[model samples]
Target: MNDLTLSSLTGRTVLVTGATSGIGYETARLLAERGATVLLHGRTDGEARAAADRMIATAGVNGERLCTYGADFALLDEVHALAARVNANHPRLDVLVNNAGTAAPERHTLTADGNEIAFQVNFLAHYLLTHLLEAALTSDPGGRVVNVSSSMHRTGAIQWNDPQRARRYSRVAAYAQSQLALTVFAADPRVTAVSVHPGVCDTAMLPLYAHEGCAPAEGAAHLVRLCDPATEIVNGAYYDRDQRVEPAPRATDERTVKRLNKLADAAVGVGS
Candidate 1:
């Protein structure tokens, strides 16, 4: 780990999705503590605004330095709308932390958009958001797209024929697939993307998928480390518990990236 600490974030701007609670909330809170102008996102406007206000009251971070945006990730149209709003207002974003994800334990659920719920919320939504914000990210050569993936992705695979797991559904398979997709997309050379396995933290998701781990603050620290400008992590690399490691073989395959990109483009109504 580098010496670049949260204090180094002074004056930078970061947008964190799912900042309402869990790791996302901790990450956003710490970043704001570091003096970054942070934009918090939640599934609804009230949720996001309330979260930002709470941060101000609890952390003493200036209200002007922190704001909120809302969008339901399970819907493609809402994702697009959120991106447009961000671009229209804040044209310069130094870092993007895609910390939002879902874990549905027992059932196979479909989004209103007709896509698998996990796939849409965890991976596809972030994919669309990243592309839409490419301009702002690339504007500063030091900008980064930090994707919160998981070590479980090592067992993940792209269901090429059934990208949405339409044929059959397994909670484990869907969650793993979504994480793998995020890692694969992070490997794209056009932008500075970093994938992170934030560890199994004790959060609301724990009951849904039980595992022993640290608190949200500890997990958020791993993300903060990656966001540190002085940290010399190679772009498009995967980090497991703050240490860079090779992801699953499929995540590094060129063919896998291409196929997934194509499918994602089609799914989001964007051209390949």
Candidate 2:
């Protein structure tokens, strides 16, 4: 494990999705405090702007250091639009925090994109966003992606032929599958990326983990650390909070990584 020292983020730009609330909000706040130009993404424009306002008010973050973007992860077109706006506005993005996610609803639901709701929001949208922002992301060295995956991914198995789980649906399985896919995505050779389980945070999704959980900021700290350029990262590495740890076996498998890229490219309408 590289002993990561958190350094000033001056002149760096970071985008954190789902920044309207919970861990995402805190992560954005911490990054902004550390001098990064934090882009706060929410499900809607108003929500994103509101998050920025709150940050400015409570965290003492300068309004000048923050920007807001809105995109509903369940909608692939919106994700593309968000990426386009970012690339046009900030050509040299330093970090992308794929933190927007949702718990699988009690019943199976599908997005307008025809994917399982959780799968689309938690994985496919991010996959598309990352690939679309390749120009900005690769504009400089040390630029990387940080996936806020989960430990629950260990229980997940990619339902290769039935990713939607249309025939046999379980909310737990659906959410885990999405997370596993995100973890596997970090291994793609096209970009520098890593995934981490940010611990059981006290947020809307707390029920999925435990009855009680730690503060959202505690979990956000782990994410902020990885976003720092000083934190040496190996592509595809998975961390549990601040400690590097092995992810599920399939997460590191080269064959699985390539296979997943194909599946995601088709799903997101990206060329292989």
Assess the local accuracy of residue 98 in candidate 1 as a C-alpha lDDT between 0 and 100: 93
Per-residue alpha-carbon lDDT of model 1 for 150-257, expressed as tens digits?
887888887888887888889989988998999998887767888999888998767544667689888898998887676666777999877888888888788887
Provide the TM-score for each candidate, comma-separated: 0.95, 0.97
Q: What would the per-residue lDDT of candidate 2 be over residues 1-272, giving only the tens digit for each residue?
A: 22222478899999999999999999999889888999899999999999999999988998999999999999999999999999999998999999999999999899999999999999999999999988898536668999999999999999999998899999999999999999999988898999999999899889998999999998998999999887889998999999999999999899999999989898899996
Q: Among these predicted structures, which one has the highest lDDT?
A: 2
Best by TM-score: 2
| Candidate 2 displacement at residue 115 in angstroms | 0.2
Looking at candidate 1, the ten consecutive residues that score lowest on lDDT are 1-10
* Full-model lDDT for every candidate: 0.85, 0.93
